[model samples]
Target: MPLLPGAEPYHRRGGPVGVLLCHGFTGAPQALRPWAEHLADAGLTVSVPLLPGHGTRWQDLRVTRWEDWYAELSRELLLLTEECERVFVAGLSMGGGLALRLAAEHGDRIAGVVVVNPSVRSDNPASVLLPVLRHLIPSRPGVVGDIARPDAVEIGYDRYPLNAAWSLARLWREIQRALPRVDQPLLLLRSPRDHVVSPANSALVLARISSIDVTERLCERSFHVATLDHDAELIFEETLEFVRRLAPDAKADDHQG
Candidate 1:
């Protein structure tokens, strides 16, 4: 399948600390590209893989399951582990759920985790009908481009594939059950004005995770897609700081201007 313009995966080799960023469901790597570039410029190796069924048409996504997306991220993490001394995983929305799952399953292999406006559960009353709805309908209106900045755009499908969404719901339940196993340092950044995901998602994860070293910050000026919103620079700087604290040997100072 031909990838959408700007949806290409990104990989840059740099220092001993590697960061893997995962874009949200229906979203391509483009959504997180700037953030990856920021980290790469800071001298950290970074990888942003286009999840399976993404970066293409929504019809393609309907045929894919959540496991496919998780598998792609897991593969990228393994590659990073082979090349770097320390690795951190971060994601936006559903990708955040995947990051948490990685921390739970991989344990000490992941140095830390960062999530932006993660989606662990749906507040929509209609979600209960997904199993049946997915069989009857192919898609629903998309939940993309929820940025506070009017000019910022998120590259993703215009509709939500019902089948894929059901799979995501299952993934969330699995992550919730395994939250107790996530002991790595966690940085949870969220937007209070997010229109897509509910704030309770972050609260549930925070209350369940076993990590002792955890920090929560509010993106007061942004929306769901905070990476491309007003506090984008804040997310980039804070992430670098968090990684630096955890991996002191990381080459964060080498690329300073």
Candidate 2:
């Protein structure tokens, strides 16, 4: 399938510290491109994979499930582990849940985790009817471009695929169940005024995760797509700092020496 412009996955090789970025449901790598580039520019290797069924059309997503997305991310993590001494995972929205799952299942391999407005559960009451609704309707209006800055745009499908959404909900439940296994450092950034995801989602994750080093920060001016909103620079810089603190690149240190 031909990927939409700007939706192609991004990869850059840099120092011994690698970071893998995951975009949200219905979202392409474009949503997290700037953040990935920021880390890469700071001498950190980064990979932002376009999840299966994304970066093409909404119809494609309907045929895919959460496991496909998680599997792709897991593959990327394995590749990073092979090339770098330390690996960190980060994601936005549903991608955040995937990152958390990676930390939960591969805590020993992942150096740390960072999530922005991660969604483990939907705030929509209608989501409960998804299993049935998916059989009746194919899609609904999209939940993209929720940014505080008017000019910022998130590149994604204009419609929400019901079947895929149901699968995402299932992924959330799995993440919640495995939260106790996530013992690596966690940095969660949320938007208090997010219209797409509720504040309670982040609260639930912070309370459930077993990580002793957990930090929660607020993007006061951004919305759900905080990566492209007013606080985008904050997200980029904070994640870079988080990675540096957790896993300093030995290559850089040797160069300094």
Maximum-lDDT candidate: 1
What lDDT score goes with residue 120 in model 1? Answer: 88
Candidate 2: Cα lDDT at 232: 94
Tens digit of lDDT per residue, candidate 1, span 191-220? 999999999999999999999999999999
Q: What is the C-alpha lDDT of each candidate?
A: 0.92, 0.90
- List, residue by residue over 1-257, the lDDT tens digit for candidate 2: 89999999999888888999999988999989889888888888899999999998999998999999999999999999999999999999999989999999997899999999999987889989989999999899999889889888899999988999899989989999988899999999999999988988898899899999988889999999999999999999888788878876633632321
Clashing pairs in 2: none
Worst 10 residues of 2 by lDDT: 248-257
Stretches of candidate 2 exceeding 4 Å from the true structure: 250-257
Top of the candidates by TM-score: 1
- Total clashes in model 1, counting residue pairs 3 or more apart in sequence or in different chains: 0
